[model samples]
Target: MPLSEHEQRMLDQIEQALYAEDPKFANTVRQTNPAVHYKRWIIKASIGFVLGVSLLMAGVIFKQPAISAVGFIIMLSCTLWGLSGWRRVVGGAEGTAAPVEGKQPRAERRGMMNRFEERWRRRQEGDH
Candidate 1:
């Protein structure tokens, strides 16, 4: 259900107070893109996966079953972590954002996934 008018006004007041107290934090929160956040999570998981592989290799070289088992567990956890975020990124890509009723410009109204992919593409182009 939607907020009642009184509740909406109260929420607006609270938001105003937050911005007044810490505009930098408010701006950061407002500009945060969920897709970028998920991407970072996936990158961290990838690093974990690499570490897990190294551990597994070390276990084999050193003949340690316990270390190998731990490495397997780490690989499993990182795979699951990466998969969860990958699903969100893919699902978000297929979804569209509804434009807010007021204030925000069209350029600023793109979906989170769209914005992230655009940034990725730009970086790729710059790299080449």
Candidate 2:
């Protein structure tokens, strides 16, 4: 349900207060894009994958089953982590294509609920 006018006004007041209290934090929150976060996650996963591969190789060379099992687990987890958000990063970038002249951006065109639902659906599909 949509917020009442009074609620909207209250929310606006709260946001303004936040900005006044800490402009830096407000700006950071405003400018934080989900895709950037996902990209960072992908980068971390890549590093982990490399580390896992190295560990696996070391385990094999040293003939240690326990070490090899740990390496395999790390590799699996990293692969899943990298895969999970791969599509969101790509899709989010694609969805952010420049708007046509005199047109609003895609992000501005959709309601917050619509965006949330879309993200939820994407997550469900990704999990499968």
Candidate 3:
């Protein structure tokens, strides 16, 4: 559902306050393109995977089990990171799936936490 005018104004005020408090961070958040960000991570993960492979092979040649184990761990972590980034990029490609203007996922998480806190406060008050 669309936000009411009052909600919109409140959001605008919050945004302006954010900008005033930290213009650099605000601009960084504003200019970020999710696709590009995830693609960069994917690239880094690809590089990490290759490095892990090389490490694994070198460990095998040098007869070091610990090095081999570390390399395997690196490979697994890189695979996970790449897969997660790929999933996010794909999921966010849809226009309808995009969040409302000026609303970040972090804000949704914060709102959920706030609701939980409020409920806890009410429960405590009722117990008194």
Candidate 4:
């Protein structure tokens, strides 16, 4: 879905703030995260992999040794093709999130211990 106008303004403000703080890093962040683009790629590649492999295996079963080699070729193509998709998943692609002070908390705080532990976790041990 497209961002609403209010959201677009908020994003603009955030970009301004980031640019003020660090122009270079802001440019880096502006580069769309690869993760956001990966799901479509994975799906397409997966389809191609399945089709290629299936055709190859079918060729092998028909006793047509000539096209049987084509089956291996197709299998190899799918293997490599599917692997590229896997590599993209491994690359840690994700949807663009609202740029914020920190990653959103995993969950709501539930106890005093949680507070203390979380605060400790956020702090550098050497600072004390």
Q: Model 3: residues >4 Å from true position, as ranges?
A: 1-5, 92-128
TM-score of 1: 0.64
Model 3 residue 9 distance off true place after TM-score fit, in angstroms: 2.8
* Tens-digit per-residue lDDT, 3-67, candidate 1: 56997799899999999999999999999888899998899999999989989989999999889
C-alpha lDDT of residue 89 in model 1: 70
Question: What are the Cα lDDT values of the candidates?
Answer: 0.82, 0.82, 0.82, 0.64
Q: Write the per-residue lDDT of candidate 4 for residues 1-128, one digit (tens) a residue.
A: 23569977998898799899999988877786765566566676677667666666777788777665675676677667666666675542332344346544324425555556556665645444
Candidates 1 and 2 compared by TM-score, better number = 2
TM-scores of the candidates in the order shown: 0.64, 0.65, 0.64, 0.38
Expressed as tens digits, the lDDT of each residue in 1-128 for candidate 2 is: 35569987998999999999999999999999988999988999999998888889889999998888888899999999987778677665555576568655755667666666667777768953
Task: After superposing candidate 2 on the true structure, give the runs of residues whose Cα lies further than 4 Å from its correct spot.
Answer: 1-8, 92-128
Residue 71 CA displacement from its true place in model 3, Å: 0.9
Error of 1 at 99 (Å): 21
Query: lDDT order of candidates, best first?
Result: 3, 2, 1, 4
In the order shown, the candidates' Cα RMSDs to the true structure are 13.5, 9.6, 9.6, 12.2
Q: Model 1, residue 63: displacement in angstroms?
A: 0.1
